[model samples]
Target: MSELGLPLSEQSLQQAHNGSREEVMRVFDEQHFGRHHAKRSVAQLEEELQKAYKNFILANEYKSSKLCEALYTRCEDKMDQLQVLRLPSMAKFNAGFLLCNRSFEEECVGPSKTIYEQRMKKMLGKSRSLFIKEYNHRLFNWLVAFSLVMVVMGRFVIKFILLEIGAWVLFIFLETYTRMFWSAESLYYNPGWHFIVAIWETLVYSPIIDLDRWAILIGVMLVILVLYWRCYGRRKHGGSWLLPLYRNHEGGSNRWRSD
Candidate 1:
């Protein structure tokens, strides 16, 4: 028996090598349960058995270790044989095979194509969700910072506008430079750039008095939202809808709840 009380004797190793996977697993469970008395689960026992089997194979010189190596070699051979058997038919292959073949692009080609599309869609959805989440967080921080700057420069409207315009120009320059340096695709499809452009255009075209009024309105609304969030929203729902564009995994906007 090994230190973990696993039966690693020559006889037990032979039984494990010759028997089915389940039978060997059952033996491992029995030995582990006998010593530990259900302190470990079946999965834990199986994992431990795998670890012991690996150690046994690594020992290399012992009879039981040789048997363990032989068992692994046999399992690998069986897997290779199964793979070889599957090579003849396209239908027997995996999603990757179907995806790589351009001929399979026709609709209702096979279940593999459908499975591949579903997997790709799921992967893209998760990636888009993560991108949106990060974008929202960055945008929120930017908004708060700009709002604070607006408050500090509120009385001096022209100075604030000049500062903001400069900032926007710098941002655009950096974005363009980075995209060019990396040979990245056009920013036309990017929502963040779209938002930035929309805001910049609004700022550029709007009247000075109108801009000041809008700024004051936004600041007041932000203050009221922050106060409400601190007093009630945080304690109640553990969430905030301060960013309306923010979406949950279900693609639904978070809404303020009434008590």
Candidate 2:
């Protein structure tokens, strides 16, 4: 109360009715009045004054307290602005409000301690359960998203591997046909183990698929794709896995460059 320019919490609560907006603003400014803590204070004041206002009306106070009305309105506006915050932010604001208004709670005690204690327990338990449910909901959403991503990546990887193997199969067929044409009379060129061995050897040495010889090539490509969208294929019409070598058809003073 001293910090708020009033000796008693009740006096501070009624300060606005006495035309002391300056004193209230001064107190807030002096406290640094950050968004979270300020909202917390406003929320506490709103709840307390609402109860007081109800009691005043019940007692047939014909003239409403201007100070209470103004204070309540101020707190209500701040709380409305603070509605953008989620559960965690709201919880933190509530905590700060409780801490800041500890003096008010200590000064004003209702006649029934048992009723107050029961209400406090019920509110705290309900709040705890609500926050726990929110946490679980967020966790479940994240897990579902993660699972979807994993499934997509897994499918892509499997497809890529099968395509690579199919490429190797095609290359073997072409190589065997070419060798038969090159050495038709040779014993090793006949349809036998020698032809299969030759295709295997060619695949091992093939410049196009040299990286494909390793089992972890799929993992390597995934890393590369993530690092550079389109991987190393950021060229006109999108480049190949191995960039195509185009013939130099232009007649000029010979000039060449290497990547």
Candidate 3:
């Protein structure tokens, strides 16, 4: 047995092959749970296992059919043990190995493809959940800050408009940065990132005003209309400021008008 407690060399593997199944299993147990093995970190163990697996594959590439079959079985069994160890990195590595080596005749392509797909799905789900949680937290904080700014400087119309434009630009930059940072592995694309990019392009590059600017313009118009109405009504009527503009003021009585 090598330092890792597994038969990694051709001579060692041949010796293990001659030995009984119980002996082979005993070696596997030692590699997995032996006292000396406990001193090594999980990362060390995984690295060793990965190296040994590659060596085994290379060594058995042109060997006899029977020997290749035997070594392949050992390799598969070792990977299964690694799975039981619950190391996600190793599990992903194993899945990739299986998928990549599906032409080895030891396993069917269907099963390897299925395992790879399952692993990818799980990884995508985890990434998406984390991305959403982080995004919501950041968005909530941003909205709170924006609200406070509006409350504090709402009387300064020009400054408020500039702030709105700045806020929109900053929001887009941060959102794009966040999406790109969270979208893992170039091999797989996140659907959320694509969707966000599509919407952004459509909104920003359109002939009409961008959505954020349009919203700001509409809001400013509404504020102006309300102010005009209040001032005009106050000047036209001598009634109390708190009274409605439609209140009857034909005589000296403050009453509702039918019209």
Candidate 4:
């Protein structure tokens, strides 16, 4: 797509050249739009644009004018004029929010930078963050509604034996996913499932299975092993691959270095 500097087939290129606003909106997701509090940032907007363009191509398995229209429609204003384009969440965040370098309006306009800036200011408020907040708030509310629907459907789907088997598999997956998810941010607030697994192992697989205190000792040893590995890796590797620190200094420092 032109916005994202992606290559398109001849047919796709032709469609983009003549694509309608609605065609573009359907492909736009939350990340394609800026953060709720930071819409004015061009970098965020462009990142979203590039992501939208790629996702659109991928999702449709090719370009269709119809798909493009749907993408455009997502970002269109209440008056039916295209406001800001949307990007899929995957596309949006992968493009990196904080790394965005263009103005919000500039990113939205894409190739037509000057025209979009003039039109955008005329149509929307100037505060990028305010625009982002409102957009994201609306999106968040939509997600909550969608989640409720899925929960209801999930309950229905879990009633049968086949579905129950599927559900059990899903439950296992959810456990693994939840552990990874919660452990990434706040392990304390996370439910004790991981610890429960640890405890279960300690009780079942250790001393009981071995008929000695070795299991208890093994659990303690495993904990120490993990702790040591983490500490050692951080100190020796000088990379944040395993123990990824959400560092404010890294973001700010990178920006400062560029300046």
TM-score of 2: 0.24
lDDT of 3 by residue, 30-103 (tens): 66776666546555755665676556545444333344345445545444443332112222334434543453
Number of clashes recorded per candidate: 0, 2, 0, 35
The per-model lDDT (C-alpha) reads 0.45, 0.43, 0.46, 0.41
Error of 4 at 186 (Å): 16
lDDT string for model 4 (1-259, tens) is 4363333344554477446333544454433654654445545645666676556565333333333333333323322221232311212221222222233432332233334445444434433344444443443333344444444433452222343344455455444554777632243233553453344335433322431225467658866865675568546855534432333366454554543
Candidate 1 lDDT, 1-259, residue by residue in tens = 2432232444455455445447766776666635455555666756766776666544423443344334334433433332342112112222223332322233222213344445445543443454444443444345445645654443242233545555555455545644676632344346765675467435523434333326567779987886686578656965543433222367445556689
lDDT of 2 by residue, 6-70 (tens): 22233333554344445555676677558888888867765665665455333322222333333
Off by over 4 Å in 2: 1-7, 10-124, 153-228, 231-259
Candidate 1 residue 240 Cα shift, in angstroms, is 44
lDDT, candidate 4, residue 259?
A: 38
User: Candidate 2 at residue 129, lDDT?
Assistant: 55
**Model 1 spans with C-alpha error above 4 angstroms:** 1-112, 152-259
Candidate 3's C-alpha runs over 4 A off are 1-112, 157-259
Q: Which residue pairs show collisions in model 3?
A: none
- lDDT, candidate 4, at 101: 21
159 Cα displacement, candidate 1 (Å): 5.5
Model 2 clash count equals 2
Best of the candidates, TM-score:
2
RMSD of candidates 1 onward, in order:
24.3, 24.5, 21.0, 29.8
Model 3 has an lDDT value of 0.46
- The better candidate by lDDT, 1 or 4, is 1
